[model samples]
Target: MKIWYCFTPLITYVADTPEELIIACATMNSLPVTIATCGDFGDPIQHPPCDGSSTLANITAIITSILPSDLIVFFKACKHYNLNGVNLPFWRNWFAANPSSFLIPELLHHLHKMFWDHDHLWCTTVVGSQEIDFRFVLLQVWTDHHNVQWYIIGVIAGAAPTDFISAIRALMEFKYLTEAPHFTKKQVVHLDCCLKVFHWLKQSIVDTGAWWGKGGGDKPWAIPKLELLQGVVPSIYSHGTVMQWSTDPTEHVHIRVVKEPSRAGNNHNYDAQVCRHLDRRDKVECFDLILQIYDPTLMKMTVDKAAGNFSLPDLCPAVSDHLN
Candidate 1:
C-alpha cells in the first residue's frame, strides 16, 4: 500500500530545520512516502546541499530513486499568487461595479451591522474591515492511518478561494490514487462528489465573478467553500469509514498547539523558539520510550488516560443487589 508523507516549512515545530526533517524521512524504511510542500517557499528545494538550479527536477529524481513507484512529490499551489490571480481581482471589479451590494437589505440582515446583541458588536466592525482588509487563507494537508491526521501546509495572508480550491483538488487526487488498484463503490462516489464540487467552484467563479453568489432581494448569499468541500462526507459514511485527510483537525493543532508555543516569548528569534520547542518534544518522546520499556502499563496510562477511576452509583437497587 502507498503511504503518504507531507513536508511543510510550517511544521518547523517538529524539526529545527528542513534538512534535518529530510534526513529523518530518508532513514525511514517502510511504505513509500509522498513529500508535499507549498510552491512559494522554495524550501527543501531552494535550501541546503540541493543546488538551486533545476531544483524541482532534482528533488523529483531523488524521491523517485528512493521510492520509485511509491513516492509522490507534489508542489502545492501558491496561495499568495492565487489571491492576486483570482480573489483580489474579482473583489475589486465586483466592489467597484456594485458598491451598494454590501448595503443591500438582504445582505445587511446577514451582516453584523444588524445584530442586536452587545456580544456581537465586535462582529459589525470586523465585517466592515474584512471588506477593506481581506487577508486570511489557509492551506492544509491530511493523511489517514489508524486515524486521520492533518497538518497546516500553508497559511496565506489574503482573502482567496484559490488556495482552498487547490487544496481540495490536490487532496481529492490523493484520495483517488491511494484508494486505487481497486476502488469500492462508495470511494467512486466520494471521488465523483469531489469532482462535482470542484467543477461547481470553477463555475461559481465564472458565473458570479466572485467567490460568492450575487444575492437577490431577500436571499443574501455568502459562499461556503469549506462547507462545499464537505460534500465528500456522505460518501465517506456510505463507505463505512472516515479518513484523516482533512484540514480541520490540522487547523486546530495550529491554533491551539503550535502557534502559541512558537510565539510564547514574543521574541524575534523565531528559529531559536522552534528549536527549543523541538528539543523539548524530543526529550519528552525519549522519556516516553524509556517508560514504555520498563513500565508499559504506566506508559499506556500516561498516554491515554488519567490514573484514577470511580464507579458509577447504583442505578437500580435490584440490579445492584444481583451484582453484589
Candidate 2:
C-alpha cells in the first residue's frame, strides 16, 4: 500500500512551536506540555532535561493527567505544562491519535529549516556570510536542500574547524537518507548512526560558542527541531519513508489553492472572497465533469466548433473589411 494513502493531511502548517503544541494538545484533548525546557546542565547530553521531560521522552502520561476528574492534579499539570487554565482542549476526544503517532516527519520544515535556522546560521557566523556567499556563487547552481548539502563542507573547508564540518556533514547525510523513497533495515541502522555522529560532534559548536539562540547558557542546543531528530527513525518505522509525507507537495499547491485565489479578492475580508471564488471554480469544474460524463465528445466538439468559427475578420474586424 502507498504511504500517502495511510494518512490524510490536516492542519497544513502552524506559525511556530507554541502553536504546534496547542494543536497537538487540542488533537489529543489534553493540555500542552512544554518539553523544550532544560534542567540537567551537568549531563553530557547537551540540554538534557533535569526532570527528563524532553519531548523525546514519553510525556503522554503527563498530558493524560489533564483529562481525569481530579481537579488538583489537573490544575497542577496545567501549571506545569505552562497553560493558562484548567480547561481541557476540545480535541482530547479525538480517537486513536496523539502527536507522537500522528505527526510524521517533514523534510522541508524539519531538516531544511534546522539547517537554515541553526546550522547554516552558525556556519555563516563562524566563517562570515560574505565568504560563504562568495563560495556559493562560484559553485554550480543547485536547488532546495541540495544547494546547501552538495558542497557545504567543501565550501567551508579549512575555514571551519574539523568537528564543526563533521557535525554538519553528519546532519546532511541523515537528511539525504531520510529523503530516500525507500529504505531497508540496514539503511535505518545507517540513519541512526548518522544521528549519533551528529550528537557526538555537535559539542564543537558549544565549545566554539556557535549555539547562539534562545536556549542559551547551559542549554545551548535546546532547539525543538534539533531534539526532533531522535524521533525520525521511529516515525519512519510507523509511517513510512519521510519522502512519502513531506510537505513539499503541499507547499507547491499553496500558491494555486491559496495565494492565487486570495489575489482575486479585495484586500478587505479577502479570505471570504477567496472561498467564494473557489466555490464558484469548484461548481464550474463539477459542471464540466457532468457534461463530460453525459457526452464525452461534447468538450472536444465545442472546442472544434469554436476554432472553426474563428476568422481573421472576427479577430481583427478593421483588417477583415480591407481584405474583403
Q: List the global CA lDDT of all models.
A: 0.32, 0.63
- Which regions in candidate 2 have their CA more than 4 angstroms from the true location? 1-20, 26-77, 82-98, 142-145, 237-240, 248-253, 294-298, 301-324
Q: Number of the top candidate by lDDT?
A: 2
Q: To one decimal, what is the Cα RMSD in angstroms of model 1 from the true structure?
A: 20.9
Q: Write out the backbone clash pairs for model 2.
A: 28-92, 29-91, 29-92
Report the Cα lDDT for candidate 1. 0.32
Q: Per-residue CA lDDT of candidate 2, range 1-324, in tens?
A: 655535433423322344555645422222122233333211223232212122313235555554546667765665555443324443444443354455555787778777888878778877888998888888867635667767777888888889998988898899888988988999999998998898888888777667754646655654666665666787677777777765566676788789989888878788788888899999989976975786554445222364454234244355334433
Clashing pairs in 1: 136-158, 148-244
**C-alpha RMSD for every candidate:** 20.9, 8.7
How much is 273 displaced in model 1, in angstroms?
A: 3.7
Candidate 1 local lDDT, 102-127, one digit each (tens): 11111111111112221122222323
Model 2: number of clashes?
Answer: 3
